[model samples]
Target chain A: MNDDEPLIRWQWIADHTAELADYTGIHLRLGLLPVLFGLIISVPLGILCHRWRWLYPPVLTVSNIMYSVPSLALFMIFVRYTGLTEQTVMIPLTLYTLSVLVPNVVDGLASVPEPVRLAATAMGFGAVRRVIQVELPIAVPVVIAGVRVAAVSSISLVAVGQLIGQGGLGYYITRGLQLDFPTPILTAIVLIMLLALATDALLVLAQRLLTPWSRNKVTSA
Target chain B: MIRFDAVSKNYPNGTTAVDELSLELAEGGITVLVGPSGCGKTTTLRMINRMVEPTAGTVSLRGRDIREVNAPELRRGIGYVIQHAGLFPHRTVLDNIATVPMLLGWNKKKARTRAAELLELVGLPAEMAKRYPNQLSGGQQQRVGVARALCADPPVLLMDEPFSAVDPIVRAELQAEFIRLQKELHKTIVFVTHDIDEAIKLGDNIAVFRTGGKLAQFDTPERLLAHPADDFVADFVGQDRGIRRLSFVNAAELPLRDGPVLPATAPVAQARAADEPWVLVVDEGRRPLGWASVAELADGGTLADASLTPLGHTFSLVGDSARAALDSALLSPARLAVGVDAEGAVVGVADACELSAGTTAVQAAAGEQASTEAESASSESRATVGKTSADTPGGGDR
Candidate 1:
C-alpha cells in the first residue's frame, strides 16, 4: 500500500466497528490503570526513600531492574499468570512506570531547599504537614517531569499488548502482514501517533494547573 | 519564663553544635541568641521547641518540662517566624496565616477572619490575604509570616534570622515593628540573629553562643555592652558595640544650660557679657542671632552691630543624648551651639567640659568591671587565642 492509503480501508474499520471499539477500550484500560496506579504508589515510596538514606539502595535497585526489562517480554511474563485477561495486559505496563516516577519524586523532594524545610519547621509545621503543604507543592515541577515521561511511554507501549489474546492498534500491523492489506496497518499507526500527541498536550496543561511556581519561574526568568 | 538546664547536642558526624548551655529567659522579654555561623545559637533555639532534640539536659517553659508535653502541642503554644516567611506557595496568604489555628480546630470562617485581622496587626493590607506567597514582596511575605506565628496568640515566639531575607530598609522596619509588638504583646521571645547591633537593639537579654555550642555569656544588653563575660563574648560583640549602645539612650535626658542673649538692633557692646567677652545674640524671641565680642561692641558705632560672626549651627540637641550635646558643644564656633525648642526659643547650651566630665564618670563606673575581666582574659586568652580563631588574630586588640 502507498503511504497515503492504509493496508486496510476505512470501510473495513466501519464494517468491524464493534471489533475496533473493543481494541480501543482495552488499550485505554491497559495503559491508564498502570500509569495512574504506579504514580500514586511510587510517589510516597520515593518520599520515604528520600527521608532515610539507609532505605535508598534497596529502593533504587528494584526500580533499576524494572527499567531493564523490555516491553514485549514484560507483557508476556504477566500474560502467563493472568491468562490473557485485561489484568494481564495492565499489570506489567503499569509496573514499568515505577522506575520513572520514583527517582523523579526523590529528586524533586531533594531539590526542595533546606531553608524552606527549616522555615516550615520554625513556622510550627510538623513533619507530615510540612511534606504535604510545603515540600509537595515546591516539588511539583520535578515530579511532573517524571509523570510526563512515564505517561508517554505507557501510551506507546499499549501496542505491545497485541501479543496477548486482546489486540489493540497492533492488531492492524499483524493482520495486515498476514493478508497483505497495508491500509489497516497504516491507518492504525496514524491514529496511534495522534493519540500520543494529544495525551502529551493534556499532560502539559495539567502541569500548568498543578505547578504555578514552575510557570512563574519560566515567565520571570 | 523559659530556662535551659545544661542542654547540649552532638551530631552523629562528631559536629558538636552545642555544648552544655544553661540560661534563663525572663517572661515578657526579648532574649536574642546571637553569634557567628555554626555557633550553636540556632541549635539552642531549636531545642526550646524540640526542633533539634538535645543530647543532654532539657529546656522548660514556664517551669513545665518541654519533653512532658506533646511536641506538636508545645510547638503550637510557641509562635515561630523564620527567614523568607516560608508561606506555602500553593496557599493564599490567608490560608498560610491560618495554619496553626486550623490545626487547633478553628472553624473555617472564624479562622479566616482572625487571619485577616492578624495581617493588619502586622501592618499589611486586608487585600493581601487573597494573594499567594509568591505574589507578595519579600517584606509583605515576612509580615504575613509574623502574622501566622501570632495567629494562635501563643505566649512565646521564636525567630531565626527572621528579617535577614529582606533588604536593609525593610529589615529595619521589621525590627521596629517587632519591638513595638513586643511592647504590646510582651510574649516571651527567643530571637536568633547573627548581628550584634540587632541583638543590642532588640534584646532585653543577649545570649552569645561560641562555636562548638558553648554559651559564652548571657546577660542584659547594657551589661553585655558594659561588661562582656569573657574575651570571646567581647570580640563577638565587636569593637564598635559602644556606638551601637548609643541607640539605647533617649534624646530627652541630657542637662541643658542658659546662654547670654543679644538683641538684633542692639549695639554689640549691649549684647556682650563682660566676663566672657563673647555673648550669644538673639532676636528677642530667643532664636539665636549671632555671637558678639566685647571689643567689637566697645567700639560703640551703629555699624558695630555687624552679624558677620554668625554662630556655626549643629542639630538642636534640646534634651536628647549627652553625646549629641557633647559633639555639638565641641564642634561649636561659639564654644556652644544654641539649643532651641520647637518654638525656636534658645532653650540651653552645653559646653565641651560637660562632655569630657560625663565620659569620665561613665568610664569610672565601667572601670571596676575592667579589672575582673582583665584577670579572666589573661588566663582564657592564652588558651583560646589560637584554637577558636579562624579570621580573628590574637583576640582583643581593641
Candidate 2:
C-alpha cells in the first residue's frame, strides 16, 4: 500500500511464469470439461426431443430452470458432495451449458430440409442411418454456433469458482484482492478473456472446415 | 409390369384416396395416371412401390404382391422422381447420384464412375460433379434427381409430377428428354400428373381419374382424345380434343403440292403469273427462303427483289405431326404449312382445309384398324382385357 507502488510489478510476473502456466492449464480444463460433458449429454437428449416433439418443451423448461439457479448456489450445493474440488466448480458449469446446448441440438436437427429427408428415405436409407449420415452432418453448422456460445460463457464463468478456492487463474484475483494488488487481477482477467476469444475463434474455424458447402451460396448454372 | 387389382385406399379420416381400382399397366412403356388433385393418381403411383399400402387389395409388381416384400427393399429396386427434385443439399452432385449405388453396397470408385456416366446421360457437364445441389438451377437439380433415380438401373420408374416444378419451356425440354430416355431404356414407368396435355404428350396409355378417386377411363392417348368414355372424361379431355387428336396423326399423311413454290432466282413476272395470292420463294438448294405476295411483286427484277415475308415456320414431314402442320399453317403469312425434308429442303405446302381433310381420312383408317383389333382382343378375353390389348398396336407404332 505504498504511494510509490506501480500498477503492475513486472518482476513479479517474470518470477511466477511457471505458476502462471500451471494456473492457465487449470483454467482451460475447469472451463472446457463442463462444455464437453454438456455436449455429450445434450445431443442424445436433443435428438429424442426432436423425434418425440412433446419431449422438447419439458426438457427445455427443466434446462432453463436449472440455468436460472445462481451459479454460486449450485457450487455450494455441489461442495457438500464433492468437497472443495474441481468437480464442485465443474458440476455447476455443466448444468449451465444445457440451457444453450439442448435447444441448439434440437434446432440443428430441425434445420435439415424436409425434401432432403424424404429423398434419403426414398433412396433406401433406413431411419438410423439417415439421421447419422445425413441429418447429423447437415446439423453441424447450427450445432457449432451453439457450442461457441456455451464455450465462451463457460470460460468466463470459471473465474467465479474462485469463491471455493478451485477457480484456476481465479486464484490470482482473490490473492490480489487480499493483498490489495492490481497486477494479478488485471493479468487473470486479460488471460481469461484471451482464452475465451481463442476458443470461440477455433470453433468458428471448425464450423467453416466442416461445412464448406453452406459457407456461401453459389448461383452458377 | 404393375397391376393394381381391386385396390382401395381409405384413410382413418374417412377419405377414400383410391376406390376399387383395377389397372394393369403394360410393361416397357409410360402409363400416366392423370386427374385433378385428390383424385389418387399420386396414391396409385405410390402403391406400386408400396410407399402407400392399399387398404383393401393387392398391388402386384410383375405378378408378385408388393406387400410381401420389405418396403425399403422394394423401394430400392424401383426408381422414383418427385417434384422439387428433393436433392440432398449437403452432398455433391456426384455423391447424391451415387447414393442408391452406395446403399446397394457398390464400391466407392464404382459408384462414382456410374454417377459420372449418368451425369453425362442426363446431359449435365462433367465439371458439375463436384458442385453441390444448391449451386444448381431448378432444371439442373431435376436432371440430377433423374440421374440419382436411374443410378441402380431399376426396371421400373415411378414419377410423381416430376417436371411440374419447372417453367413451361424447361418442362417441355424435360418431357422431350424423358421420352428419349424412355425410348432407349424401355422401362416400365408409372407417371402421375394433373395436366391432361402432359399425359397426352408423354403417355402411351393414360388412366383418367375423377375427383372421387373413381377410374373414369383408361385408354390409349389417341383413343382417349377421340373417344372419351363419359361426360367427366369428355370434359377432362377438353373441348379442343379434335385439334389435340391431330397430334397423333403424322404430317406425312397430309397430301402436299408444289403449286406456288418458286425459286428466288425466278423472275418477279413468274411469281405474279402464279394463280395463288402468295408464292413461296426458295433458295437454290430448295430450302424455303421466304413468302412473297404476288400482288406486291415489283415491275422488274427477280422474285428475290420482291418484298419478302418470313415463312412463319415449317413442319418436318419425317418427324412432326399433323397438329404441328396445322399450327404452322395458321401462323404462316401465306396461309400454307410448308413441309420440309430432313435435310431442311422444302418438300411441299398444304393449307388448313387440306390439312383438315387429311386428318379426317387418317382418322377413318385408324378407326377401321382399331375396330378389327378390338374384335380380336375381345375374343381373347373380356371387355377390360380388350381395352388393354387395343392399345398395343398404337403403342408399338409410336
Candidate 3:
C-alpha cells in the first residue's frame, strides 16, 4: 500500500490492528488514570481548603494559574524535570485534572445547606464524620461533573504529548502527518472524540449511582 | 437542671449578646427565654449546649461546668432542636430521628425501634419513618425534629424557635402537643422564642430579655401577666395582658341562674306555662335538647311539636376558664350560656348580662386567690393548672 493512497486506507489499518489496539489502550489509560488519581488527591484537598476558609482563596488562585498555563508548556516543564518518558505526559495531565477538580470539590461541599450543617453539628456529629458521611455524599454529583470535564479535556490534551515522543493514540496522528496521509489522523481524531464521550457517559452513570438522592425533588424541610 | 451563673457573651467587637445572666432552671420543667430580635434568647439556649461559649462565667449542667466536658459528648447527652427542624434532607425521617441513638452506639435495630417510638410520641404516623424530611409538611418536619432530639431520651432539651417557621394554625397545634408531651416526659427544657404568647403558653418560668441583652423579668407566666416588674416588661407583655390573665381564672364560682324548662313530653299548655321567651326542653336524662320558643308552638301543639332553636354552646364550671364562659355567653343565640355537669346534664343557665356581672365577681375572687398563691407557689400546683380537665375542676370552689 502506498503512503500517499486515499484517506480510507482499510488494508493498512487492518494490517496494523495490534498496534492500533495497543495505542487505543494507552490512550484510555492516559485519559482515565489522571482523572482517578486527581479525584483521590483533589477531593480531600478541596474539602480541607473548604474547612479552612482562609485556605480557599490561595488554593483556588494557584489552581487557576496552573490551569491557565498552556498544556504544551506544562508538558515541556515536566519533561525538563523528568525526561522523555510516560511521566512527562502523565504528570502534567494529572496537574491539569487537579486544577479543574479541586474547585469543584470545594464548591460542591460548600453547596451543602447551612441548616444541614448546623443540624449535623447539633446532633453530635464530629467534624470529620460529618464531612465524610453527610457532606461528601451530598456533594457527589457536582464533584463528578467536574471529573467528566477534566477527563474529556485530558483525553484531548494527551494527543499533544506526541511532540515529546510519548503520544498514545496520537502516535497514529504523528505517523499520518509524517507520511502526508490524512486517513490515520482523521481516524485517530474521530476515535479520540468517541473515547471522550464514552468516558463522560460512564462518569455520568457513576454520578447517578452515587447520588440517588439528587434525583428527587427536594423542598426545604 | 441547668444553671447560668454570671454568663455573658461579648463579641470581640464589644457587642454583648447575653449580659451577666444568673438563673437556675428547675429539673423537669420548661424555662423559656423570650424577647424581641437580638435580645439573646437564642444565644442563651445555645450556651446550654455550648454551641456558643460564653465569654465570661459558666453554664453548668447538674452542677458541673459544661466546659469541663467535651463539647460533642456534652451535646450528645443534651438534645437540641431548632426552627425549620433543621433536619438532614438526605436522611429519611427515621434515620434523622435515629441520629443521636446511632451516635450513642445503639445497634441499628434498637436505634430504629427507638426512632419509631419517638415518631409516634411526637404524633407522626409510623409510615412517615421511611420518608425524607423534604417530603413532609413544615409541621410534620418539626415533629420529626422533636422526635430526633428526643431519640436518645436526653434528660435536657434545648429548643430555639422550633415552631416559629410554621403557620399560625400549625404553630398552635405544635404548642399544644408540646405541652402534652412535656407532661409525660418531664424533661428539663430551655426554649427560645421571640413570641411572648408562646412563652406564656409553654414556659414554667419565662425570662424576658430587653434590648442590650438585659434580663428585665423572670417569672411565671401568670405573675408576668398579673404583675410585670417594670415598664419594659409591662409593655412587652402588652396592654392586653389583663385579658390573658383571664386564662388562669376558673369559672367554677360563677353563679348559675335557672331558666324555665319543660320535658320534651310535656303538653303544649305546660310548655307555654314554663316558657319565658323561650323554653328549654330536656330529655329524660335531663340533658338539654334545644330551646323551644313559646310563640313557635301552636296553641294545641306539644313541646316536641314546637320549633326548636339549637343551643349555641355549653360551658363547664368545673374546668372552663372565665374567658371560656364569657365566650359561651357571647356565642349563645338566646343570649344565655348553659352550664353542664360531667355527664352533659344541664345544671343551669346564665344570660349574657348575668354572665358579665358574675364574671366581675369571679375575677375579684380569682385576683384574691392569685395573690395568695404567690407566697406558696410550687411547680406541682402550676402543673395542675395546666392539665385542667372537665373531670378535674381547676377552681377550688365548685
Candidate 4:
C-alpha cells in the first residue's frame, strides 16, 4: 500500500516465467474444457429441441435459471459434492455455458433456409443424414458466432473461480490483492484479456475455414 | 409410368387437396398439371413421390405400389425441381448436382465426373462447377437446379414451378432450353405451374385442374385450346385462346396470293394501274422491298423511284406458325402478311382474314379427329389417358 510502490514490477515477471506458463496452460484447460463439453451436450439437445417444438422454451428457461445463479454460489454449492478441487469450479462453468450454447445451437439450426431443408429431403437424404450433412453444415456460421461469445465469457469467468482454490491464473489476482502487490493483478488481467481475444480470433478463423460458401451474401431468387 | 387410382388426400382440417383423382401419366413425356393457387396441382404432383401421402386409394409407379417402398428410397428414384432452385448454399455447384448420385452410393470420383458432365448438359460452363449457388444469377441457379435433378437420371421427374422464379426473358430462355432437353432425355415429367401458357407450351398432355382439386380437362394442348371441357376450362384457357390456337397451325398452310406484288422495275404508270391501294415492290431476286402506295406513284418514273412504306415484318413459310402470319399481317403497313421462303425471297402474301380462315380449317380438321377419338373412348377419363404422343411438336418451333 506504499504510495511510492510501482504499479508493475518487471523483475517479478522475469522471475516467474515458468509459473506464469503453468498457470496459462491451466487457465486454458479450465476455461475451454467446459465449452467443449457444452458443445457436445448442446448440439444433440438443440437438435432434439428443434425436432420437437415444445422442448425449446422449457429447456431455454431451465438453462437461463441455471445461469442466473451467482457463479460464486454455484461454485460453493458444487463444493460439497466434489470438494475444493478443479471439478467444483469446472462443474459450475460447464452449467454456465448451457445458457449461451443451447440457444445458439437452436438458433444456428433454425437459420437454415426452409427451401434448402425441403430440397435435402426431396434429394433422398434420410433424417440423420440430412441433419448431419445439410442442416448442421449450414448452421455452422451461426453456431460459431455463439461459440465466440461463449468462449470469451468462459475464459474470463475462469478468473472468478479464484474464490475456490482451483482458479487458474485467478490465483495471482487474489494473491496480488491479499499482499497489496498490483503487478500480478495487472499481468493476470492483461493475460486473461489476451486469451479471450486470441480464442475469439481462432473461432472466427475456424468459421471461415468451415464455411467458405457463406463468405458471399446469399441472394434469394 | 405412374398411375393414381382414386387417390384422395384430405387433411384433418377438412381441406381437400386432391379429391378422388384417378390419373395415368404416360411414360417418356411431359404431363403438366396447371391450375390457380389452392387448386391442388402441387399436392397431386407431390403424391407421386410420397412427399404428400394420400389419405385414401393407391398411387402405383410402373404397376408397383409406391407405399411398398420406403419413403426415402422412393424419393431417391424420382428427380425433383422447385421454384427458387433450392440449391444447398453450403455446397459448390458441382457438389450440389452430385448429391443424389452420392446418395445412391456412387464413388466420389464417379459422382463428381457425372456432375461435371451434367453441368455441361444444362448449358453451364465448367468453371461454374466450383462456384456456390449464391454467386450465380437466378437463371443460372435454376439451370443448376435442373442439372442437380438430372444427375441421377431417374426415369420420372417432378417439377414445381421450376422457372417461375426467374425474370420473363430468362424464363423464356429456360423454357426453350427445357424443351430441347426434353427431346433428348424423354423422361416422364410431371410439371406443376399456375401458368397456362407454360403448360400449353411445354406439356405433351396438359391437365387443367379446377379449384376443388377437380380435373377439368386433361388433353393435348391443341385440343385443350380448341375444345375446352367446361366453362371453368374455357375461362382458364383465356378469351384470347382463339388467337393462341393459331400457334398450333403451321404458317405454310395459310393460303397466300401474289396480289398487288410488282417488280420494282415496272414503270410508274404500270404501278398506278394496280387494282390494290398499295403495290408491294420487289427486288430483282423477288425479295420484298417495301409497300408503295399506288396513288403516290411519281410521274414518268419506275415503281422503284416511288417512296415506299417499310414492310413491318414477314413470317417464314418453312418454320413460322399461323400466329406469326397473323401478327405480321396485323403489324404490316400494307395489312398483308408477306410469306417468305428459306432464302428470304418473297413467296406470297395473306391478309388477316385469309390467315384466320386457314387456321380455322386446320382446327376443324383436328377437332373432328379429337371428337372421333373421344367418342370411341366413351369415358372422359379414358379419352384423356396416355395421349401424350406427337402433339408435343406444338412447342417445337417456339
Candidate 5:
C-alpha cells in the first residue's frame, strides 16, 4: 500500500516492529525517570520546606514558574546549553514533575491532624521518629495521588520532547506529519494515552496497597 | 512531688502566658490548674514535662530540674493526656496504649500484654484491644488515652482538659472513673481544665488562675470554696461556693434520730401506734422499702395496700459526704434522709431541718477551733519576737 493510499497502513506498522520497541522503551524511560527523580528530590525538599514554613512560598513560586514555562521552550532553551542530549529533555521534564509533586508532598505532610502530631510529641516521640513513623505513613495516600497526576502528565509531556528531536512516541507523529500520512500519528497518540493510563493505574494500585486504612471514613476519636 | 518556683512564660509577642507562678504539688494527689481561656493553665501543665519552657524560674520534679533530663526521656517518665484523646489513628488501641512501653524498649509481647491490662483498667473490654481509635467512642478514646498514660506506670501524670471533649454524661462517668483510678493508683497528677466544678471535684489542691496568668488563689478545694483569696477568686468559684463546701464536711458527724420504722409485714394497728406521722417501712432483711403514713393506716389501709410513699433515696453515713446527705433529705418525700449500712439495711435518719442545724453547729465549731489556733499562732510569734529582743542587742536599736 502507498503511504497515503490506505488510511491505517497496518503493513507499515508490522514491518517497523524493531523501531516500535525502541520508541516504546525510550518513551517509557523519558516519561518515568522524571517522576522518579521528582519524587526523590521533591519529597525531602517538601518535608524540609514544610518544617521551615517560611521557605514554602518561595519554593512553590519557583516551581510554579518552572512548570508554567512551555515544555517546548524549556527543552529548546536547555538545548543551547546542554547541546541536545537526553539531559536537555530530561531536565525540563523533571522540573515540571517537581513543580507538581512538591506541593502535593508538602500538603500531604501538612494534612496530618494537629492533634495526632501533638499526641506523638506528648507520647515522647522525637521529631525524626514522629515524622517517619506517624506523619509520612499517614501522608502516603495524598502523596501517591500527587504522583499519579505527575506520571500521567509527564507521559504526555514526553511527546513534547519531539520539538528538540528527542521525542520517544512523538517521533512517529513527527515522521507521519513529515510524510503527510495520518496512520503513524493516530498510532502514536493511542500508544501515548495508553501509557499514561497504565502508569496512573499502577499508582492507584500502589496507593491501595500502601494505605488500606484511608479507604474507610475516619470518624473523630 | 513537682514544684514550680516562680516559673514564668513570657511570649515573644509580649503576652505573659504564665507569670511567676510559684506552687508546690504534693506527691500522690491531683493538683488542678484551672482558669478562663488564655489564662495559661495549659502552659503551666505543659511546663511540668518541659513541653513548655519557663522563661524565668525552675520547675523541679522530685527535686531534679526537669530541664536537666533529656526531653523524650523526661516525657516518657511523665504521662501526658489531652482533650480528644490524641490517639494515633494508624495504630490499634493496644498499640496506642503500648506506645510508652515500646518507647522504653519493652518487647512487643510484653508491651501488648501491658496494653491489654490497661485496656481493662480504664473500664474497657479486652476485645477492644485490637480496634483502632476511630472505631471507639469519644469517651472510650478518652479512656484509652488515660490507659496509655498509665501504661508506663509513671508516678506523675499531666492531663490537659482530658474529659472536656466528651459529652456531659460521658464526662461525668470518666470523672467518676478517674476518681476511682486515683484512689487505687495514687499517682501524682497535674490536671488542667477550664471548668471550676471539674477542678473542685478532682483536685486535692486547686490553683485558680486569673485571665492575666496570675495565680489568684492556691488552696484545697474546701478551703478555696469557704475562703477565697479575693473577689476574683470568689466570683470564679461562683455563687454556689457554700453548697460546694458541703462536700468537704463529713455526714457521719450529723445527729441521727431513729424515726418510726416498721417491718413490711407489721400490722396496720402497729403502724398507727408509731410516734411519727410517717413511718419507714422495711423488708425482712431490714432493707428500706418506702415511707408509710400512719394516717393511711388509721383510714383502714392495710400494710399490703399501695398507699406507701416512695423513698426518694438513701445515703450511707459511713462513706457519704454531707452534701450527699443533704441531697438525700431534700429528695425524700417525707423530708428525711435515710441512713443505710453497707448491707443496705436501715440504720438511722435525719430530717432536712436537723441537717441544716448540724451543718451550722459544725461550722461554728470549726470557726472556734480556727480562732484558737490563730490566737496561739500570734502568741507564739510574740514570744519569738520577745526572745529575739532579749537575745540581740541590735533589737534595742530597732
Candidate 6:
C-alpha cells in the first residue's frame, strides 16, 4: 500500500464504520469521565485555596508540575508502575489534568468581583451560601472556559491510551506502523482530528447555553 | 431604639474607626450621624448591625446586646442600606430585596410578594422588580436598596450615605420620600452622611463626629444649629447659623393685623389699620386679595381694588428643620412668607426682615465669605426686630 494514499484510507474508514462508532463511544467516555472527576476534585480544592491564601502557593506548585510533566513520560511512568493497563493510562491522564484544571477553577473563582461578594455578605449570605449563590454564579463563565480547555485536552490525551491494550485510534496508528500498512494509520489520524474538532464545537455550544448573560455582554461589547 | 455604649472599632492594621463613641438613636425618628470621612460615622452605623464588629464595647438594639445574638441572624433582622446602594448586580431588583427573607426560608411566593410591596412603598412601581441592578438609574437603584433593607421590616434601619450616589434633584425627592415613609412606618433609623444639610433635613437628633472617631456634639437640629458645641462643630455646620434659625419662624406665626373688608361703599376711616403703611385687602371670608398702600387707602380704595399679588402663602409645617424652612422662604417671592396649617389656611406670616437676615448669613457662609456679612446682617436685623424692614428690598431668607 502507498504510504500517502488517501483513497486507501477512505476505503478503510468506510469499511470500519462500526469500529469508528465504537471508537467514538470510547473516546467520549474517556474524555468526560476525567472532566467530571476533575470538576469534583478541583472545585472544592479551589474553594479551599480561596478561603485560605496560604494554600495557594503549594496548590499552584503541584498543578504547575503536573502541567509541565511531558505527556509521553507520564504515560511511560504509569505504564511502568501498573504494567501497561487501561486503568493505568486513564488514572495518569486524569491526575495530570488536575494541575491545569485546579488552577483554572481557582483562578476562575478568585476573579469574582469584590463588590459582588461584599453585596452578597451584606445581604446575609453565610460562607457556604455565598459560595453556592454568588461566587459560583459569577464564576460560571470562567469555569466553563476552563472546562472547555480541559475537555479538549483530555480528548487528545486519551487517544494516547492506544499505547497499551486499549484499541483506540491510537491503536490503529500503532497497528499500521507495525504492519507497514498506511491505510489504517492515516484513517486513525483523520478520524481523531475530526473528533477533536467536533468535541470542541460541542463545548462551545455548552458554554453558550450555560452562560447567556455572558453571551449578551460579549456581543453587546 | 439603637444605643451605642462605648463602641470602638480597631481594624487589623490598628486604625481606630470609631473610638469609644456612645449615642442613643430614638425609637421612631431619624438620627443622623454627620461627620467628615474617617470620623467613623459609617463605622458607627455598621456596628449597630454588626457589619463592623466593635472592638471594645457593645451596640444594643432596643436594649438587647448585638453581641449576644448571631451576627448574620442579627443582620437579617436589621435593615442595612449603604452607599451606592451596594445592590447585587447578578440578582433582579426583587431578588435583591428578597435576600434576607429567602435566607430565613420564607416561601418564594411570600418573599416575592413582600419585595413587590416594598418596591411600591418606596415610590417605585412593581414593574421595576424584574430588572437587574445595572438596568436601573442611580436613584432607582438606591430606592431599591432601601426597599430591600425594609423588606424584612426590621425595627431599626441603618442607612450609610444612602443618597450620595444620586444627583441633587433625585436626592431631594428621595429625602422627601424618606420623610414621608418615616411618618408612616415609624421605623427607628440611624442615617450616616458627610452632608451636613442632609443631616439637618432628616435628623431628629444630629450627632456631629470629629476625626479620630470622637463625637463632637449630639443634639436636636435646632439646638445644634442654634448653638454648636465648639469652633469645630460651628465650622462643620457652616458659619451661617442665624439664617438657619429663621426656619423656625413661619409667616403666620408673626402677628398679622386683619385686613379691611372694604367693599366699594366702605368708609375709609374704618377701612385700614392706621399703624400700617400698606393695608392688606381681603374678601369677607378673610382670604387676602391684595395690598393697598395708605395712599391708596386715602383714595378710598376698597380691599377688592388693592394691588394684591397672591400673598404667596409660605408656611413652615411642624417638624420641618430650620434648613428646610429657610429653603422655602428663599424660594418664595413674598418676603413675608405665610405659614399655613395642614388644611392650607394661613397660620401666620414670617417676618421678611428676619428671613432675609437669616438667608444672607447662610449665603455669606455658604459662599465662604468672611464673618463680615454675617455680623452686619445680625446687627441690622437686631435693629429692626420690632419694625417691618420691608424697604430693605430683597434681603429676607432667600
Best by TM-score: 2
- lDDT per residue for candidate 1 within B38-147, as digits (tens), equals 99988888898888899998888888989998887788888888876877777788988998888788899999999988999999878778777777788888988899
What TM-score is obtained for chain B in each of the predicted models?
A: 0.76, 0.95, 0.86, 0.90, 0.89, 0.74
Chain A TM value for model 2: 0.97
Q: If the candidates were sorted by their DockQ against the true structure, best first, what order would they fall in? A: 2, 4, 5, 3, 1, 6
For model 6, residues B295-384, the per-residue Cα lDDT tens digits are 554455445554544444444455443445445445544444444455544444455566566555554454344234444654332211
Report, to 2 decimal places, the DockQ of model 3. 0.46
After superposition, candidate 1 runs with Cα above 4 Å error: A1-22, A217-221, B257-398
Q: Model 5, stretches more than 4 Å misplaced? A: A1-25, A81-85, A179-184, A218-221, B293-301, B360-398
Expressed as tens digits, the lDDT of each residue in A57-135 for candidate 2 is: 9999999999999999999999999999999999899999999999999999999988788778778888888888899
Q: lDDT tens string, model 3, B1-398? A: 58788889999998999888776777889988889999888888889888899999999898899999998888899988899788876788899999999888999999999899999999988888888876789999999999999999999999989999999999999999999999999999999999998999899878889877777777778778876767788899999887677676676777887887678888889866764777888898888888887877888856877778888878787888766777777786667788888888888888766766776776677667765674355532332211221112211111
Candidate 5 C-alpha lDDT tens digits along B133-183: 877899999999999999999999999999999889999999999999999
Those runs of model 4 whose alpha carbons end farther than 4 Å from true positions after fitting are A218-221, B259-275, B281-289, B297-308, B371-398
Instruction: Give the candidate order by descending lDDT.
Output: 4, 2, 5, 3, 1, 6
Q: How much is the lDDT of residue A120 in candidate 1?
A: 70
Give the per-residue Cα lDDT of candidate 6 at B104: 87
Q: Judged by lDDT relative to the true structure, which candidate is superior, 1 or 4?
A: 4
Which residue pairs in candidate 2 have backbone atoms (N, alpha carbon, C) closer than 3 angstroms, thus clashing?
A: none
Worst 10 residues of 4 chain A by lDDT: A212-221
Better of 1 and 6 by lDDT: 1
- TM-score of model 5's chain A: 0.92
DockQ values of all predictions: 0.23, 0.66, 0.46, 0.56, 0.47, 0.22
lDDT of 6 at B63: 73
Per-residue alpha-carbon lDDT of candidate 2 for residues B88-132, written as tens digits (9 for 90 to 100): 888899999999999899999999999999999999999999998
lDDT of 1 by residue, A1-221 (tens): 44665545678877877876676666666666788998888879988988987787898898779778887787778777888777776787777888888888899899887766776776667789888878988888888888888877887787777888555777777888777788677767776677667778888888889876544422110
A24-130: candidate 5 lDDT, tens digit per residue: 88999999998999999998999999899999999999999999999888998999999867778889989998888999989999999987888888888999998
**In DockQ terms, which candidate is top?**
2
